[model samples]
Target: MFKLCRLKYYLRNKERLIILQPLTSSLDEAFQRYSSSAADKDFLHRSILPTDHFQASLPRLPIPELEDTLKKYLECQRQILTDDEYDQTVDIVNKFKVTEGLDLQKRLIAKDKRNKHTSYIAKPWFDMYLKSRLPIVLNNNPFMYFRDDPRPEYQNQLLRSTNMIVSSLKFMKTLRANILEPDIYHLNPAKSDNMRFRKIMRMIPTPFVFYGAYMFKTLPLDMSQHKNMFNSTRIPRPGKDELVVNKEGRHLLVMRNGNFYVFDVLDASGNILEPGVIMASLHQIMQDQSPPNTEPVAVFTAEDRDVWASYREKLISLGNEETLKLIDSSIFALCFEDNKPTDPNAITRMFLHGEAGRIWFDKSLSLIMSAGGNTCVNFEHSWGDGVAVLRYFNEVFEDSTKKSVVHPSTSVQTDAASVQRLEFKLDQEMKENLQQSVKKFNSTIQSLDVHHLEYYKYTKSYVKKSGMSPDSLMQLAIQLAYYRQCKQTVATYESCSTAAFKHGRTETIRSATAETKRACTLFVDNHPAVSVEELKKAMMACSKKHGSLTRNAAMGKGFDRHLFGLKILAEEEDGRLPEMFTDSNYQKINHIILSTSTVSSPAILIGGFAPVTPNGYGVGYSTEDSRIGFNVTSYPPSTNAPNFIECVTKALDDMYEVLEGRHPAKSI
Candidate 1:
């Protein structure tokens, strides 16, 4: 039964191709090397089949029709394959198959762990809801609607990209609570028997569950005090000691008794809290107090703004500590709406309209300078990715404005008439299926480490040989790979990458989503398949292609990766990015390059949105060889298509033609 099921999965969904070449000495070496490489990795090991004794498998369908066919198959099988079956197919092909190399395995494993941790606490109904609703949302492509009005004047107006993100997060939060009704549990790590049993069970199929209770250690308020903490991990830990002083004037520690843990000030309640809940609650608090209003309740005229900058600088130059402190606190006050303006230089007012209203200012420049000015914006958390936080921020702003302030009496009447909901029970089969899905997810993760080191080295070397920037090379390779697999002739395959810009003035916040996250994706066109030699020559030409550098140029640099990772660590420590960049009283620091590389992978890398990463929390991946990698610092997500793989394969078939520099007619 298992073999039959596996066969059906491969025949229906897998992308199989035959490589026919003249028998040569190098051919044997190539096959041996490739086979050995595949054998060492989990994904490739499953998908690859040695046919020394038989003819190679025939190409089942043209490349271009492949993606569409797969999509159709998935859609049609939606009813037949429960989440478990779908997951099983994914596992068998991605993990058990012999095609995914070692690097692919590592990526898959990382994703699997993440997904499992997330699922452990996730409601099955919620996962189902996401599966059902997400496809609808993607198919509708509501985001494309924002692109329709690209006028500069409307850039910051109406529902912008950030606004969409915020709306989505808010909706998800509400849906999770109202519809999913997730059970609250904690991991009790102190009990060795329980912990061991739980770990073992995690390897087996199980329903969505999280560690019921756990307590991890905490960091001190001073960086000097926590030298021992740095020993726990090689990657930089956020300088939590410094961060605590900036936000809450104390050190915060992560307490974990088992899997359940909490990050809080020492001696505080140690209940495990949901990161999503914290984000939603924080957003609600900010939005409710400061509803979206067109009129700037706080503004500065051109002259007053100049004078303020001058005065602040003078005080700082003269080492006037008291005045500097006052200025710093005042800026925070402006950002947080904690104080009223005294001796107002420019007229700043707050305005509120009915739901679906706009926040506008009569003063053109002043309004433009504020958040809703020339650029649309959204906040992000230090720990979270920019995209996710921006989504939450936008949602809060939109939801806050949409709420109509009804009289207390009306509210009471509505509540009194509301009906209590009943809990629906899942049958035994349904429960078993949910458990199996989770197990399959774990199995995929286990396979990721099969060839981690080798795959990483090969990929790194391949990127270098391509002679394109890291982002661009990755994008090109992905495109080529996808083209080979799908064999489609689309007009263009768009690739995009994002850079982060920070202009908001909050030093320390509970989450990274507190600061604004903005980014853009760049697109390029790919030429159709040609012989190997020709394609290589073209690739060389493409790599040499260059244009004047813009801010986008800075983002394309590999340095951005380090900076992005640093930002998260910093935020996690200090509750936000570096304060030096956000000191409104001195000079409002804005814009930092997060991820600069081009979107070069065939697979899409959706980043800028933060992942929910609590200690030990994990996410799952659908494909063994195909996994999404996020550069958290980038503004918008980027994608690389699988066209390059196809190009490489085609090159192998017509090496002599390519060597002669014969160009093929445009087919894709």
Candidate 2:
């Protein structure tokens, strides 16, 4: 959600194509890397109850000290600023520390004290997302692709959709019944992840349950956002939007050719219908003879939030109150795409920001499938961070594939009485509004381009053997890639989850640092004096600093959230911006050039999002056992996605050569 909250993009008229910059990557290599750990998930959930039983005992997110935060903030700013600029920023920070900063810090602490059940950053973070009026299309929503089913028959579009729906509903049932395993990171799986440990945990009360796991070196993440994954929608209001959850609703929403269809996935007793019944209903919908909608109502969700909110009120006033409610409260949405895309890159674009009218972006989870069985989940951002979403994503893929909920052939009933088609009462004015929405959405999507580049020369297995942190190494590669493209250091953002604490969101792992600047200059600026040994030394320093930053962010001791809290408190309580907060360097530090995130998992094939700035690049990368991949995005003419990807591959090659003790260049 913080990815594009305060962003504004400038567009160009160039035609766009989703390009896959092919390197030495293959499906076999992908399989060898991801197939290592499916058993790890099942091992951790031997026996458990109440997925959220540990919530009451989870630790609260801590507030970093004011001076500590200012110091760390300057460390990040120093790399991006000149000496003169750095001195000015330091002076401004000092003044704030003695003045508005102290009061704001006190007020924030008191507020956190008053709200012990949640984190200090929770409310301000929510407010930041809610107050920003950017349309959630490219600005906020992000997509994660699932690896195609291994069996050819299961990849059939109808079969894939039916199986995924059944798997997702099963997941919801497990979660609602408190049987789903809690999200936990175990340091020693052998000791903390077995049935013995789980049995001990179940013996404790809810308030003290986490301590049982903590004793065995286990940590449970806050699961507050998981509930929003079902029966929820983000309602656009005039000033601020609302995230509403209605657990009472029990139906599946289907969007095809811009028409809305609903069917009861649950019985009167609230138990899920059998998989055969779901397959029959989906098959019936696919055979429907209705023509494509001339004016799709889903396009209204793509409009600017205030405009959409205004029209939403107009929609309700037109005697469609019950209709809108039913749509919002459905379990989740499943979208059927009309196009069959052969190029994997095109599939990424289709899933990321597909045809606007065919997408209902307000729904928390929308499972989209093409006619050829390419599928992904396009998720709304405000309700949760990736930790919550990824848990659902990974489990759904595993359950559907491993359990085989439905076979290739299932008997269909002519009348699945629960299926209902949703009809909107649209006037001529609303119909005209739909045409304008299409124009606006088209203009917005045209400016962005996406590319995926995979580097198979080496991956995490080699990095681990070389005694380097894989995440830290990849972050440096990204920094090096940007410097090679731009010839300078700039602000960078790496996502780190703080979900170990109560109601935690995310903390910025400020990736750009002084050591990274020295390393990039040595490698990319072609400095002749830098030896291979010296370059390796510099790389180690960069990785070490990055690892420290990641740890600090995960521990909730990072400066980003602490500084954000102070800024928020100042605005909320004093109603004025501090001089320090108004500094130009402060603004520059938050511009977030090279916004990169590492998305490595067994279930996800690729993940991506739009850049946070008009010219900046959004980089989603994965470092696996034997390969690395980058899904690069940018608004072209201002920036180039294809060229940026080329630089990334070059950076990875150079870094790997350095790791191999090769003299890559005379300069380095």
Candidate 3:
């Protein structure tokens, strides 16, 4: 016992020394100094901002050392490439690490020193997303479906619509006043501020080369002008601070019968419209059904990037200037659907690929509230990831359902006409283009399929009992399933949130690690040579490694985003992309075959997408104490989503049986 104690003591001291050695080494001098700075310490302790006053106080996303990035990149490449390709890629990476990489690093560091952007990676990230040719709906945008509202009164369409508008207006007021607490990493005040949340909240979806926001005033709902509720009498004049302070740009576009009408959600005195008035206005919208004189304009957003760009130019040439401004300046959109969904999955499916005319896939976000009070949000991933939209949904739900938030009337002029309809001037050729877009969009949505699985026999608690990280276990289960089905491990992207740093989005947590591969291989083989105990040990080690990697990513020390920033900087400075970045092996490995993220929420029923790449699966899961639910999506006729989920179900049950020495668990 004494010898064992001494051995443990030696091991503990050795581990401590290993951790401390990095601080003294020249390799990590910048990180050490930054970590020790009193100012940074103080900054971390400061309260989350009510405004952008403390924006500069947050730390910038750090650029990882080039050699380190190359090492990780090469390791990931090995999982996806042939031996010959791997060797060629290794040679390219070696050359890069010694020469061009050094130059790129210098340029990136210099840019970091000179620029004051919220994130060094933001510009390039945004540019790549906007320029991509993929259609928005399932390809690039994410959807979150909320569970059914418990209150029966919310089932009333008019009341539901009115209350939602009120709740949204309240949310905007809190936003403009900067009272909505910025989501800190783990709710830690010292961690990075999620300021990107504010940007997407009031963002407008435009059909131009770029997206922009509008300036407008919120008016009380009018019952007298039912027919004109979809019409506007006044377009608020731009103020001196229209570029920034016109926080009133919270203009919401309402979609009904494949048509759109814009309206400000707040009254002139910054008050929520009375529920009765809002109800009447919604009633008016439901009553009016106008036939199309031309093609639906929003369908153009679903076209290829270049195709849409060209059409947008044509649109501007034949533009109604007022309509263009209305589309540009609106903060966000709200779609009131006439259809009702019976289940959470149904609502999610509707939001992801709703009927074309009633949906606007180009906007930063569109809040779709069904007549039955079922709700979901479709958001553009180019602006941000799921976290930002999740925060918005949380706020709205909390204000509307969780609390009895009240707004008193100030007795301002109540009759001001605020809502307006956008009139488009389309020629015959443009109408033809719209028809083609609709066909393409429909084809894409039809090819997509979803399989919602609820594995109830085992959950997070069972995994915890086995002394394994639930997330790591889930990831391993997915890898095993894919390998069993496809007979190989390809590139996998598990979103590691970097909200711990200011303006950070996500880093790719390379889920296909060596240990995971080994464990998966053993499980698939059910090798008698490999004991269950040995497999458990391997899984636990993999889980620990994954946790460490995720924490590093949260600290802005991940590979993908950092390397992305460096590559962009190199292009700007040298007038060409580095050879290593252009390598075919590099391109092949980065094609994510599995895109997965988990958003564990009681209020959120499911969150997910259609895979970003053609032959991949998009997996969104929620692992609760009692059950594990998976929302899996893929493009069928090329990739089989049902087969993937079948493998997943088997893998999950098999894993549980192996770990717990029990009969296989059941899954649905």
Ranking by lDDT: 2, 3, 1
Question: How far in Å is the alpha carbon of 348 misplaced in model 3?
Answer: 3.5
Ranking by TM-score: 2, 3, 1
Q: Which has the greatest lDDT?
A: 2
The CA root-mean-square deviation of candidate 2, after full C-alpha superposition on the true structure, stands at: 12.1
Off by over 4 Å in 3: 1-54, 186-250, 289-294, 343-346, 404-421, 663-668
How many collisions per candidate?
100, 0, 4
lDDT of 2 by residue, 1-668 (tens): 22112111101111211121121124334534543555322221222346887899898899988999999999889899989999999999999999889988889999999999899899889878777788888888899888888888888888888888877877787777665788998989988886556555654556666666676789988998888899999999998999999998879999999989999888876777776778878887888889998878898887889999999999999998999999899999999987899775788789888876898999999999999888898998888989988988888888778776677765566565457898999898988888899889989988889888878999788898877788888888888888888888989999999999999999999989888988888888744566789978988898889889999999998898898888888888889899988999999999987888876788888888899989799988888876788898999898888888888878888888899998574232
The candidate, 1 or 2, that scores higher on lDDT is 2
Better of 1 and 3 by lDDT: 3
- Candidate 3 per-residue lDDT, tens place, 1-668, comes to 44335434543465664664554354334534654575331122122224332233345578788788888888878877889988999999899888988878887888777775556776677566655665556767788877655676554555555555666555555454544444433233222223332232222111210111111111111011111111112121211001111244546677776777877655676565555555545556666677642467777666666676677777878866667566555556678777887764666678887776667676666778787767777776665666666666776666566543222222222344355677788888988888888888788777778888889878888888888888888898889889888888889999976654446667888889888888777777544566667767778888987887777776777788877887777677778988888988777777888999988766687787878788899999888877888888887777888888889889887777778764343332
Each candidate structure's TM-score, on Cα atoms with residue i matched to residue i, is: 0.21, 0.91, 0.79
Which tens-of-lDDT digit does each residue in 497-542 have in candidate 1? 1211111111110000100000000011243443455455555443
Better of 1 and 3 by TM-score: 3
Give residue 456's lDDT in candidate 3 (0 to 100): 88
Off by over 4 Å in 1: 1-246, 249-467, 489-533, 544-668
